[model samples]
Target: MARKISAPSLFQLGYYWEAKIFLTSVKLDLYTPLAKGPKTAKNLAGLIEADTDALTRLLDALVSIGLLRREGDAYANIPELAEFLAKTSRFYMGELMLLQDAEWDHWGKLEDIIKTGKPTVQDNIFMNTPELGATVSKVLHRMAKRVAPALAEKIDLSDYKTLIDVGGGGGAFTIAFCQRYPHIKASLFDLPQTLKVAQENIAQAQLNHRIELIEGNFNTGPLPGTYDVVFASDILHYQTEAENAALVKRLYDATEPGGFIIIKDMFIDDDENEPGWNAVFSIHMMVYSEKGRCFQGKKIRDWMTQAGFDNIVEIEKNTILAGTKGV
Candidate 1:
């Protein structure tokens, strides 16, 4: 008989360990200082306001988790981690760490949520107020500004002139695309408060002339007239299957013939266990938003087809579904 297999506990322990590291590193801005150059423990101790011994331990822990790299007795931030995790970098995930912490706080009470079949997050925290919701929405847009631009180049946006970025946080995709393809004019649509930040971000990028900012809830509000492409990044996962289908159909109607729609979000593989991010993201969606859940690309493809889109293909692009509308 074949030997019984077992999963490793290292990963579970590592998860908690990494959580601590991420929390602390973001708190101390460790990556930013070291991003300037490798620094000795003494320097970091002063910067973090901790004792040499405690700082050394924290640095070692971060190094062990691969968030930091040690050179001899000094420490340096890993390039990728420095760029994305450091507070000083444009791609900083520090605020996102706080958002993740907020989500995990709700996850701590998941047992009760499961028992009552009730939603949490915005209910227990954030006061369920429109203003607070707007604040969190801006934070999310800031997050999009940090993470989405890096992935922008991975897709081909050269062909389209007018594009609509649905739920575009901070208008990052539009900023990046405008910088790359000077001819591609873009529009961003989101909640009013969120659009406020998106407009500022676009202006800061000095691309205000290239992009338009519109405020409206995609589900209930009227979409702007036809465009060459409608791109939904980190937007669709927050809706139910039926709602996503409806929105896809709506996007199809709003798109001119031969135009395309892009749906980008996390997805699970058919086997259900592959690509670990999908599994974690599913739980995250449950804790964070109502009717949100990570899904499979195949199911999404079906939804696209049902919504009357053609040329549906899961290209080598980032976790996105791109398809064209037939005349």
Candidate 2:
């Protein structure tokens, strides 16, 4: 059923108090110390060099939100969340939250942007700050460990011999694709700085020979070479519709006949109200990017069709699409 609402619920929706508190905890690395053992607010404050009373209030608030547990005066990190929140854990996802914490100030310009039809930032994170962008990409890679492998399961790449991962930050998708399809050679393409980080990842995966690192911006020129599969994952949302369409068209051009082009991105419903995540993400894009916005699926499919792709299918609803370049 569609989300039902009441007056109180509507009011609750406006509250971002819990979100900010949670983000604050992640930013402060509070969970790391708590992971060692339960600690009093004073102990935590002394370690972090913050006021004891204020840290107590914040810790109590975290208890209220179920992220921490309190017994008397000591607070403990929730066992399950510690896997993701503890700095020593292999699965720590603090970096992604740090990125959000960094961008919190840009959201302050939302009202002014809405009124003036302008953005707070000149470019998206990837283009404006490559170092931070590379780190954030690695964080996302760890957070969604199954994303690319799952995509590999969905798409049939058995016959394809080569692939190009456009804007392939950290080479996550390329790594997954090559791992799943051993016969295929892959190219991971992105800015030079991002490729350096990807190089380290590829080496760690021991796939340096199977995956080639190609350094170039996809937006500045045509992709370096044609391939059996041109896969641009999680990249289109950072551009205007015109740029997205043009990129899709280029993907079609680079795709060899009898092969495919795939774009994986958040596509909002035409009514612009459901899949609540993408809807709100569109607003985030508008505030943080000069032209980025979540787009409608059919609009992008139409561009693919216009570019002469045949047998197009939406492999996942409003998320991924695969189009064939007819022989």
Candidate 3:
């Protein structure tokens, strides 16, 4: 007799419950304390000021989800969680996780968005809220610190002297590039409030002299200055296709003859079928913004070519694309 196959697990709704639990843990600053060492439920409760029984249950759930580990009656963060989830760690992701926690409210309106085919809110609440904006900026800065080093290694900046990081939040890429190439000077273009956060980060990096913060809305006007390298990372998905094309034309004009233009974003395939994350993110854009959606890499490349870019290359498995303007 053939072995019976169990029905596929259909705990789809459980994902949100699990996420809520994880977010609650991060909100309470549980992982940071666990980073010190293993501790019992009572000890953790005292450290984070939570109810002992309640905290223990949450810890047990985290352990089941593989975020924490249990040995006997003590609980501790897993190695990966300790490094990235602990508030004290350099690459701490608590702020980003908290941002998601805040988004839970927005996400709750997804059913309505799907039905109405429109965003429930007119503007991004997080951007409108100053405190939330600052938190988001800090998270972006930390994420950039992680990605920038790899980006610097992949791209050659020896010949590039001046760079314009359009819509550059937190100035993480600029700081990383400037540190890697001592001769490079970068200007970070963003809104006034975001530039404030970027300024603080640049000062902290001690690259204040090298990275200049320029305040403007790139969506409405042309870039302020010409640059040897124009870089925009994770900015394209926030606009419609026509807007991105127009922006690419503007970026081309901002680029010096023979200069380079680099666009780093989550680009989907032409069919928009493969790369599951890109597809899901396309929906995320739909729910978040009125016109934003992930664009096809081929379409973006075609736009570059039409704008007089030459020798375009896709790197980092199509996440980063670069093209050079004719001299």
Tens-place lDDT digits, model 2, residues 92-183: 88998887788789888888998999787888887888888888788866754658788887788999999999988888788999999999
For each candidate, give its TM-score against the true structure. 0.75, 0.96, 0.88
Off by over 4 Å in 1: 1-11, 14-18, 28-85, 114-116, 122-160, 273-276
> Candidate 1 residues 1-327, lDDT tens each?
223345686567546767866786777778878878999999988887878988888888888878888898899988976877777787665766766665656778778877987677442122255565555666666666665666567677778788888888667777877787788988888777677777777888898888998877788745888888888877766778888888888888878898888888887765654544676687777787766777778878888898888998775433778899987
Per-model clash counts, in order, read 0, 0, 0
List ranges where model 2 is wrong by over 4 Å: 271-276
> Against the hidden true structure, what lDDT does model 2 obtain?
0.86
Model 1, position 81: C-alpha lDDT score: 68
Clashing residue pairs found in predicted model 1? none
Error of 1 at 193 (Å): 2.4
Error of 2 at 225 (Å): 1.1
Per-residue lDDT of 117 in model 2? 91
* Candidate No. with top TM-score: 2
Query: Alpha-carbon error at 5 in model 2, in Å?
Result: 2.7
lDDT of 3 by residue, 64-112 (tens): 8898999788997898768888878988888878877877777888889
